[model samples]
Target: MKTYQTSHIRNIVLMGSSKSGKTTLAETMLYEGKVIDRRGTVEAKTTVSDNTEVEQMYQRSIYSTPLYTEFMDHKLNFVDTPGSDDFVGGMISAFRVASTCVMLVNAQHGVEVGTEIFGRHAADYKRPMIFGVNQLDAEKANWENTIDSLRQSFGKRVALVQFPVNPGVGFDSFVDVLMMKMYKFVDENGTREEYDIPAELMDQALELQASLMEVAAESEEALMEKYFDVGELTREEMIRGLYLGFQQGILNPVFCLSAKKDIGVKRLMEFIINVAPAPSARLEVLPDESTLECNADGPTVLFVYKTALEQHLGEVSYFKVMSGKLTEGQDLVNPETGAKERISAIYAVAGKKREKVSEMMAGDIGCTVKLKTVKTNQTLCAPGVEYVLQPIVFPQAKFRTAIKAVNEKDEEKLGDALNKYSAEDPTITVQYAKELKQTILCGQGEHHINILKWHLNNVHKIDVELYAPRISYRETITKVACADYRHKKQSGGAGQFGEVHLLIEPFVEGAPQNNRFKVDGKEMVLNIKGKEEYTMDWGGKLEFYNCIVGGSIDARFMPAILKGIMEKMEEGPLTGSYARDIRVYVYDGKMHPVDSNEISFKLASRNAFKEAFRNAGPKIMEPVYSVEIMVPSDNMGDVMSDLQNRRAMIEGMSSQKGFEILKARVPLAELYKYSTTLSSLTSGRATFTMEFLEYAQVPSDVQEKLLKAYQEEEKED
Candidate 1:
């Protein structure tokens, strides 16, 4: 390998839907660069990029694998990202680190969900994009139809940069519009060769060339004028303007290649090295609050986008150097924590292999070792720099399930395994529910958790169990009631005796953040906004200063009484549902001189809660999430109708690239299996991401059904 002074570096990430040939494409590129002796297929489980034990079994790229090749006098660092939506976090992380998105598509499938998934990301980041139609050598592959799908999915701006001379079984070469020449290759063993355009295809090639020039001319006002005046443009002018357009995201060039056969990869490599913008050429970001710009020579600031746990090898910290040169053995301040650490070692990562580099210049991607305190999304920069990149936000877990290891001994190991996995993948969060008493694992879908399980057992050698997560439903009262309780349990010589009376009502979000206690045993009405109030009697040792008129209740003993009432809330009234957000009014109560302990007051408070809950109407609250679903416009009616049946409230709808974007709020309970259902309904076209929203009351009938199910399950247990 050799280095060049006029060196060019391309930070590109290969992204697309599964089986779209992303991993195989990386394999082809490595083979083309002679990095590997033999190319590995996804079927044979020998690909370098998908080397993970789990990925090998599944035959997909489940993580981002960084691989680079020095070719065409340029160093291209390719971040091969996973195609499965389960690992979408990897895809997004790659996009944030890369300046270009090389979106791959299956020639036969055209623009499938995988292509569309990464396409949205490329558009969002405003990154330059190039489409590669892979598997062109596969039987019955149609290049033109794939281009049409791209046009339908993207727009008319999608132009052919290289045209395949022979497609499907006959695929052998491609015509480069820029060079105006044809290059041929035999995919049988992926041998490079040269070819002239077939005479019969010359006229079509000329027509495509005309379209290409027109697009290139439209890239700039001056070029447009030149083309209209002379009816033609020089090759230099076309190439220069087209490169500008692509760099500016004004044009998306479609290139052809068969990663399986490695045809057209040389041209693909050349385009990446020549067309992709250099590190300095791309934009550098700065905090909105700061005046300092991101400078390579300025104090170094690197954002750790991902971290890996390497068993006995400590940790591997992968970061994006936003500015300044970072060399091994140099110390820099952590802009986040203000702690300085000597750069231990710097290396370019490929799969699990690390290639030691003495230095990683500005805009270069690499990894370092043994950073104890750092994790994913942490900022590591010069001391006192006080700069931080925004956190890597992810969509709320749309699906959840109870996860328990098969053996009790694996319980702690399960937690440890999840912690390690979470360190690598920030999107997956595992939490223990105290009330549900289950280790709840939240993720994108069932397949998402399944992949984690695969990684856990095989990669980390830990077995785990999984089941549907328990629903966290809260119980509340509808009507207002008040009652008094007198505890007369005399197990001790002093005896346990206390009398308490209290009133309970619903609480709202705007209720005072401060908790106040008043001991005025008076009558107060429970009023829900925009609804009538139920006048109820207040009687208890507990007193609730629930936004009532002044002098309504006394202040003294109210705290103790409220504590008693709180004990009841912790236990619940009808079902032990941990009653949430309820106001308890303790008007008055008599304490036994010798027996009124906290236990007696608690018992008295419990009775009062039951009385109030019976008088006041009770309702159930379920969690809902704000969801935005992106689907093709044609599926709008079907989606809306299906959502309506699921009790989804559509906020609005909009059109995007032949797809309908639906914004709606739906209860979490109805969305557990939505991924599978949406796939079935749209035949795998609709995709959605959801975030936690406010809780809403469940309708009476639905609540009854849910309650019945819960009660039946309880009985079974």
Candidate 2:
């Protein structure tokens, strides 16, 4: 395939709720462009975008699949994204590369939850979007009702450029309200015929056409002046107004099409070329993002939306060239980490396949190879250009699950594969919990996490077992106490002798996590950040300024005592969790100047802290997460009751997308397994997301049980 410039490309992404006919719509677009002779139904899974076998079996898109078509002069590249909340990463990745998002709205369902999600994503990225109200031929599809629902659900800000002329059963095709003409189809057999507005629908069409013109006229001062002077907008004037309104987010042109029957499909294509904003007009993106205009001569740059790891072909970098042309083997530097790497190859992506290309110009969305240092959210620049293109700020992953290698033999391989996917997709986060000793994976929802495992198992040949993620609970002191330890050794030529005294006190509520350890003996010490490293919080003296006036403990031994205290804090006092916020005071202690070295004092201080914890009232604290479950309002009571059972405290909530957003603070321990439970209760329709909110004190009864359990488990070990 020959290299295409950015101006020749029309990167449109198909996004909407599950089963909203996005794949079919995309197939129709492909068929009209003559890219494919036979259009495969979603049931048959022969569609180009939904090519995965799993998608065929399930009959739904599980990931974003890029498919391209050359429509006359424009290279119409499209990505069909999954509608389910679990596969949100697919939407995020696809939206990043495309200049516009073709939101497919189900006339029957109106604005569903997933539609709201992609709409928010588009608004966040400031990407111009066009809503495609599809399936006009299906029963229960009322065009007027759908528009009302759109206004009620999405907002009245959406402007309709066309309305379905023939309702469902009488479904002939669509009427271009702005153009004041009707485009009808002869039948469902891909035959088309243009005619004057059907006599019966002309009256209603004129009213809507006028309303569209009025809305457009108000968007532009010139159009408003034209309307005032002539009392009507010229045909050219109206079209220009509509396009400009769309470019500025004022007009969300709504179009009608029945991809199943291929009716109105051709008109939609024409609109894409005519009314749809060009790559140069899709919300002028700034490389440095100071409200930039779409300029072709700006610095050559592309935002790496995603990185795909191919089993045999190796790593592929997919990006949208925002500015100047980026050719093969160019020196590209990452603005995020200041790491420089040379691009080895450039390939225009087409579905699961790719066409080798030597260069890609500005406004083009494509990929490259051998970019080890480049990553998602990183801007690739052509030196001295120094531009940080804005990256899509997506919602944080809330769903958590424990991951284990299916085959223990490939455990390390699984770890490596997960890191690659995590780096490739910013929405999915992978973390290793030291205390739980388990690798935890997080995503937008259960479906999101499941796709990761599927890819790992299928593409990487590494299977993984998934469970709930471990809650990172902590244990700290509630009261203050004092303790001391003395050690004496005379078994060898060099004997060991050391002594330590410490005051263990709880830091104020929500204290800073920093910890300080000081020396008051004859050893050197270090007070580190997370572990141990600092030698002082103050000027080095402890307790009374006169407590160690006579040098009861030599200053040389202070380092050893500090080191021991540092190790003890990381090892924890009661539950082996990291101890923070508490200050250790070595007020009075005796150390031998000659025999008491760091190791000798370390042994003494380690024991002293363990004894102090017993008296300091060290308590266990469990992590609690702020969870928001979006469910049909009908299930509000059920969700509330379920949260109550999980030891949760409700926060605040509101309604969105025919669902109620129920907010609650629940212990992470109980929520770790909520993914499977919530799915079963909501029949896989309800979605709940959670983030690590804060850690709180475990009730005495619960704390006692955990303490006993820990002791028993330790005994077994």
Candidate 3:
């Protein structure tokens, strides 16, 4: 294979909603470039982009598949990304490496939720976008509605470079306004012939061409001046103007496509090769806030955006050359890990097919196998150069559940499998929630987790169950109370005798410490000897005061007493939850000289704290999350109503681009499977994000139920 310069390399990503024909279009593009002899359909499970078995079973692209085609003496590398938001990680990773986005829109559905979501992502990343209206041959295809939807979503930026002539079934041709010619496809094999605009369609073609020229002219000062002087632009000048506008993100050109029939596939590739931004068009930002120019002469630097474990190949790490050239057998150091890795072999990837390439230049995308310590988002540079590239920031996981293997023996195996899956896809996160004593798995939505489960059940041969995760509730007291506990045990040789009288009170931030308290209608004052404050690991603080007057309790035993109280605080007495924000004053206690060991004092203090906590106004607190939801205006009311049923406190609501934005604070306990519910309510047209807000007290009824449930669990144990 030949090494292409940065100017000759075009990196693009195919993005759209599911069933938009992105994979089909990719197959057609590969066929048109002569990289493949025949086109493969998605239903046949033979498309290059959806090559994985899981993808074949689901008939959808789950992971981002990188493919390259040599077209017009240039290397065109594009990533086929999953359309479902459940697998948005793939799309986001592609966004980081690709400079241009080919956003496919299913003509039959017009602008869909996936289209809107992906469009927003492209805008956020500031990537140049070109719209491809695919599935033009579908029976329900509507070109006019699709165009209107595009205009509504993107405003005047929707520049029409091509429009389908006969959009429904039997669609075989389209008029290119920029070229001022009609391209007719005679067969399904992409055989095309250019003809002058027919008289019947001359007026419509001229009108669209004039609009296209004006949009292009606005992109450059020189082009605008020429257009104003001559009232028109030549073909070459128009192409230059369009290129500038597209690169600057000022205009998004629209093209027509019937990917299933190979119609307009060749034309789309040609336009991309002609107009898409070159690899060197913009400077790449580094992790240190520095920019690096794509130069084949500079020191070699490669950034790995993806890593996967193939069947035969141990591991394949895909990367883009950020600077200079990378040759096979070259040694580079991973700046983040400080580990050296030798690039043993390089291959141009076409899904499962890998073509050996001896060298790759800057801005070229390729893969290498058998790297010792290289992961996604890590950069490998020449020996002396320690430079790291900016990492892709993935969205926070919204759906969470506790996962456990059916057989206890496979627990470790299940953990290993989860780790591997998480490594391949960062969105799948796993963590052991110590408080809940359960291993929690979090991802974008239910479907995302189901896919991982499918892999575990089928591939790893691990049977697992997913259940609702327990909430990390907190325990606190509302009012002050007091109790005393005495622990006495007579054993052989030695005896245990200890009595504790402690005053419990709620701790409030910025509140003055109190040395006087009234308990049971009696006023009691304490002499403060020492006070210790500790910030609890969970949330609040524990304040302990030693007010033992006249050596009532030994100072040396204070730590042991505090330790006893700590155990109770960790496992709250109310519902075995973590207790926080309380003060304990050991005002008085009794200890035997021979039996007053740490164990005796610890046991005595533990019981004393538990009794006092129960006597006090014990309250259970649950975690609340601030949730923001985006849904269509028509479904806003239903979404809000559903949220209300989950005990959500609506914060705000607004409108944007035909969608309604709703904000609320909902308890995490109520958010179980909320993503699934929202999708069902809105017919999969709604999206949402959730974040931890603050812990708040649960209602009295909820507190009763939790207390009863905990009591039942304790009895069963």
Candidate 4:
């Protein structure tokens, strides 16, 4: 294969909702490009994009597959991404590397929840888009309604470059307004014939073309002036305006397609090659807020956007050449890790199929196998050049589960497998929660984690069970209290004795320490000699005050006393949960010179802090998350009612397109399996995101229940 220069390369990503015919469209595109002699169907498990075993079993895309096809003397590199929001990591990663997004809109459903979700992502990434109304040959296909929906969702940005001539089961042709030509397919294998536009469709085609030209003229001042003067745009002038508008995200030109029937596939590819921005159109962003151009003559650099563990290949690393040209057997240094690696082989990828290439120029996307330490979101540079590309930030995990191997012996294996999978998909995170004593697996939703489980059970042969993960509740005091504890142990040898008097009070941020306290109608003043403040790891602060006078207790034992207080704080008095935001004052205590060991003082302080904490207005606090849910208007009431039952506090609500945006603050404890429930309630037409907010005190009833449960757990232990 010949190396294509950066100017001859176009990078695009195929995205939309699930079952929107993305895989089939990709197959048809490959067929049209002559990369594949015949198109493969998703149902037959033979499409290049859905080659994974899990994807085949589900008949959907599970990962972003980088595919390249040589067409019109250009290398067209496109990634077919999974449409489900559960697998959104792939789409995000694709957004980072691609120049544009081919948002596939199902002709029958118009704009679905998945479409809106992914479309929002594209807007966030600032990537231009081209709409492909696919499955036009389906019995229920409605081109007019789909176009209306696009206009409603995207406004005037929906520029119609082509419209179906005959939609529905007998769909076989479309009229291209850009060329003013009719494209009629003779068969389902991209065999098409060009003809003049029929009289019946000429008026509509001319109107759409005029509208498109007007939208295009808005792209540049010069184009607008020319269009105003001539009242029309020449073919070349129109192409220039459309290219600029599309490149700047000012217009999203729509096209008609019947991917299964291979109708309009070639025409779409032609438009892409002719009008789409080349790899060099936009500069790549750097970590330091700078930019780099895709110059083949510049220093060689590569950015790995994705990594996958394939059947035979150990680990395939997919990367885009940011600058210069990458040749086989070239040595590059990972500036982040300072580790040197040799690129053994480079291949132009089309799903699972790989074709060996000697070199790939800047802006070209390809894969390389067997790197020592390179991972996704890492950059590799030539020996003398140092460059790091901006990393792709994946969304936070919303669903969590405590996973454990059924067989204890497989624990290590499970850990290794989880680590491997997490590397491949960053959205799948695993952490050992020491507070809960469970290994938690977090993902986008239940379906996301279920897919991981499927791989675990089938691929790794590790039988595991997933249970509800425990919430990390916190404990703190609400008022002031005082207690004194004495530890005395007598034995045949020297006896151990220690006494500690401590006053506990709630700690507020930026509040001054108190030196006087009234206890039992008596005022006790403390001369604080020294103070030590510590920021607790869980969430708050602990201030320890040393108010000992005349050295009643030596300074050496202060640490031990503080340690005892911390130990109690680690396991709160009411429940065995971490405590925070409390201040302790060692006002006075007695110590025997012979029995004043650290151990004795530690036990004494521990008992005293526990007793005082119980007497203090202790309260339990649960984690609250800021949640934003997007649901269709039809299901808004049901979703709202469900959230209310979970004790959610509705913050705000708004409407966008045909969906309602609901914002609420819900406790993490109440959000378990919420994604699953929302899907069930809204028939999978809703989506949501959650982020950790400030922890608030639990309700009185909830606190009582939690205290009782902890007491029972203590008894069992």
Candidate 5:
């Protein structure tokens, strides 16, 4: 393979809703560029972009695939991303590395939830986009309504570059407004016959062209002035203006395409090669707050955007040369781990196929095999250069499940496999919930996890079961109480004798002025021997006051007593849950020099603390999450009522675009399979996101049920 200069390389990512023809469009581009012998379709599972077994099984892309095509003497590196929200991490990773985004919209469905999400992400990344309204040949295609929906959902920045002439069924021709000509596809092989626009559509075409010219003019002051002076723009001037407008994110060019029928695809590729912004055109900020241009001769800097595990090959690391040229044998240092890695071989990737290349220029995406230390989102720079690029931030996992291997011997293998998968896709997280005693696997949704399960069973030969995750409940006190206990045991060889008098109460900072339960004692700060001073670190604290006026308990032993109290807090008296937010005061205690060692005093302190906790009004607290749900207005009432049934406290509500935004706080227990339920309720049109808020007391009935279950488990043990 030949190395292309940065200026002649266009790194673009294709993203949109599912079944929007992204994979088909990618196949068409490859075929048009002669990289592939023939175009493939998603239905046949022969598309280059969706090459994985899991993808082929689902007939949808489950991961991002990188492919390259040489069009118009320019190297175009396209990262085809999954359109499902379950694999949004792949889309995010693609956007992080690409200079431009080509968002496909299903003409039959118009702008969908996936489109809205990808559009927002593109804006967030400041990626210039060209909207491709695909599937124009579908039976229910509505070109006019789709264009209007695009204008309304996105903005007026959407400028039409092409309009389908005979859309739906026999969609073969489109009017190219920029060239003032009609491109008629005469054959299935993408052979087009060009001619003048029809007389009937000339006025509409002229009006749209004028709008396009205005959008292009707004890109630069000189173009704006020239357009105002002449009320028109030359073809060359319009192209330049459009490129600038695209780089500035002030314009979104729209094109019509029937990717399956190979209509207008070649023209779309031509436009991408000619108009899309090159990597060098996008400025990047350096570590020292300095800006640097993408230069092939600058210091070597590469950004690892994706990683995959090939069947024969150990690991394949996909990266883009952010600066300078990356040679096949070049050695670079990972700034994150400070480990050096030697680039063994560079390849121009087309799906799973690899074409060995001697070097990759800046702005070109390539893959290198067997990098031990390199991982996704890691920056590889020249040794001692100390340059670090910003890493991609993946969304937090929303759905969680407790996973266990079917065979006990496969537990270790299951963990290892899960880690490998997690490393490949950061969206899947594996964690051990110590308090819940469950190994949790979290991901975007059920489908995302199901794919991993399939990989585990088919690829790794491991069978596992997934169940609902246990909620992490907590215990805390609501009132004040006092108790005393004495440990007096004599074993002839040694004796344990200690007494503890402690007062336990709920610790609430900034108590009301009129509150009668507020302690009238002076706040005392004590510096322990080997630990930091007590500062109420965990939302509440075990505020211990050394009220030992008569030296009943030694200062050194007080630390041991606090340790015992913490041990008891780890497994609360009422239930085996972590305790928090309580104050303890050791007013008086009896200790023998020989018998009252750390162990004896610890036992006494623990007993006294448990007794006091039982007397105090202990309550069980459950984690609450702040949820933001977006649904169409028609389903607002149903969603709202469902939330209310789950004991959600509706915080606020608002309207965005055509969707209703409902904000609420709901317990984590009620949200175990909420995503699945929400999908069923809204026909998969609604979306939601949640994050952990503060913990609140559980309802009395829920508390009773939980306590009973805990007791039964204890009895069984």
Candidate 6:
């Protein structure tokens, strides 16, 4: 292997929907570059990109795999990403480090949900895009419709650089509009035979060529002036202008390919090496409102974009040199953790195989094993000249489930396994929901969680079960009620005696006022004094006050009473849920100097608070989420109706790129397995995202059922 300069390196990411030939295209690219002797297919589970056991079992990609090949004296680093939205974390990671994105579209299916989703992701990253209309050899391949769909979905900036001359079962050749030549694949061995474009399709090819020229010319003043004067651009001028246009996202050149049959792949490789922007050419925005250029002589700075665990390799961290060169045995400090790490070995990774490299130049992607403190999204730089790169922002987890080890002894193992998986993929989150009393595992969708479970069972040997998570319902009071209790115990020599007279009322956020109540046809006015509000560590607040007068109770005992009340609030009287947003007023109490201790006061306060809470209007509150669903226009009615059935309130509606967007608020209880249901209803075309909004009171019927269930569980326990 030879080391390449930053100017000769091309960092590209292959992105598209699943089964869209991204892996196949990657395999073909490796073969064409002589990095691999043979091409592997997805069906055989031998492709470099989809090498993981989960991916091999499912016959799809689950993680992004980095593979490099040298073409035309340039190093082309290809990050092959998963097409499924369930593993969108991989795609986002790839986009973060890559300078260009080659978005592959299935010719048979044309533009799909994955294509649209990743197109938006590429736009979000502002990465230059090149469209590859793949699977030209498929039986139902439609080149015209696919190109038209691409143009319609992505605007007129999509200009054709190549087109299949005969796209069908025997698809072997495509006309290159820019070169004005026909490239024919003689066989499956990737042997190419060049010829002049056929006379019949010359007009169409010339028209596409003109479109490409117009896009290229409009990107530069010199090119535009030359085009207006001479009505055309020379081949060198066109390539230069198109390269600039591509980097600016003003031109998205579409290339035709049959990755399986090895048709037009070599041409695409040539285009990448010739036209794609090098790492030094791409501008990097810095945190100090300045731009950092990729310079090999500058201070060392690398951004870790992906992390994975191999069978014998421990933890392999893949990173891109953002500013300076990285060499083996170099010491760098992780700015995130302020920990120093020494790179023992550097390897250029190609799927599961790795080639040890002494050094990697700036803008090159490589991996180092066993960095104790370095993790994904961590920036490693020289110790003295410290700088942190922007980390990749992953999407929020949409689907969640309560997970527990089948055998209680393996609970600790389960936690360790989950931590490892979450470290590799940040989109997968594991959290202990104390209020719900369950360990919740959250991911992009059901498939994502299932893969994590598979890893847990097969990789870590920890068997676990996933169930619907419990809703964290809250308990609150609506009205005011007063109760008194006396704790009297004469078990031994010393007696325990304490009496508490407390009034419980609904808490409001403003100034405390007198609470009026009618007791037995008598008006009773209770004045709040010295109110103290303590915010609960979990959520909500506990309001307490000492309205004691005339030495009714010692001031020191008020803290003990409040503590007792909080203990009872932790397990509310209504249904054992945490109580919140309630004020407790201890107006009077009696204490014996010898017997009345903290225990007696606590017991009396707990009993009195429980009695008053039950008498007051207690209600259960459930968590609500704000959901935004994107679906095709035809399925909007069905989706809206389904949301309404879930007791969701339709907040707003809008349109985006031929899709209908529905915004609503729905209770978390109603959203169990909703991702699976939404897929079934919309044929896996609709996508949605949600975030926690606020807690609202549960319906009366739901509250009744929950209370009954809790009571029954308590009895059984």
RMSD of each: 5.1, 5.2, 2.0, 1.4, 3.0, 2.2
User: Number of clashes in every candidate structure?
Assistant: 24, 20, 0, 0, 0, 0
- TM-score result, candidate 2: 0.87
Predicted structure with the largest lDDT when compared to the true one: 3
lDDT of 3 by residue, 1-717 (tens): 678888999999999999999999999989988889999999999999999889999999988899999999999999999999999998899888789999999999988889999998999999999999999999999999999999998899999998888999999989999888999999999999999988999899999999999999999999999999999999999999999999889999999999999999888899999999888887987767789988899999999999998888998999999999999999999988899999999999999889999999999999999999999999999999987878989998999999999999999999999999899999889999999999999999999999999999999999999999999999999878888888898878788887888989999999998988888788988888889999999999899999898787888888889999999999999889999999999989998888888888889999999999998889999999999999999998899889989999999988998899999999999999999999999989998999999989999999999999999999999
Residue lDDT tens for model 6, 1-717: 899899899999999988999999999889888889988889999988888888999998888889998889988999898888898888888887788999999999999889888898889889999999999999999998998788778988797888888898999889998898998889997899989998998998899889888888998998999999999998888898889989889889999988898888888888988988888886677677577778898888988988888788899999999888898999999877889999999998899888999998889999989999888888899888778766788998899899999999999999888888898889999998887789999999999998888888898898899998988888998888889999999898889988999988888778456667664466776666688888877678888878888877888888889989999999988788888888888989898878988888899999999999888889998889999998988899888889988999999999987888899999999999899989889888898999999888999998899989999999999
Instruction: List model 1 lDDT by residue over 1-717, tens digit each.
Output: 332221366788898878888888888887776667788888999888988777887777778888876676666778888877777887677776678888898998898887887788788888999888888988978888898889987886697878888797878888877777788875556677766667887887788889889999988999999999999888888887788889889888888888877787778888888778776675555556443333467677777878877768778888877777777888777766667777788887666656787876667778898776776777777765766776666656756778888888878888988977777777788888877789888887668888888877887677787877776666676545566777788775778776666556566545552333322445444322112122212111222543323423233434555666666665555455566666665555666666767666667767766777766777777778898999877777888898998899999888877888999999887787788778778877788888878667799898788778777877998
Candidate of highest TM-score: 4
TM-score of 4: 0.98
How high is each candidate's TM-score?
A: 0.89, 0.87, 0.96, 0.98, 0.94, 0.95
Indicate whether candidate 1 or candidate 2 has the larger TM-score. Answer: 1
Error of 3 at 388 (Å): 2.6
Q: What is the lDDT of candidate 3?
A: 0.92
Task: Name the regions of candidate 1 deviating beyond 4 angstroms.
Answer: 1-7, 186-200, 287-295, 459-463, 489-492, 509-543, 546-556, 593-599, 633-645, 705-717
Tens digits of per-residue lDDT, candidate 2, 676-705, equal: 677677766577777877678888988888
Backbone clash pairs for candidate 5 read none
lDDT of 4 at 72: 88
By TM-score, is 3 or 5 better? 3
Off by over 4 Å in 2: 1-8, 139-145, 165-170, 187-190, 225-231, 282-293, 328-345, 455-463, 490-494, 509-547, 592-595, 628-635, 653-664, 673-689
> In model 6, which range of ten residues has the least summed lDDT?
511-520
Find the number of clashing residue pairs for candidate 6: 0
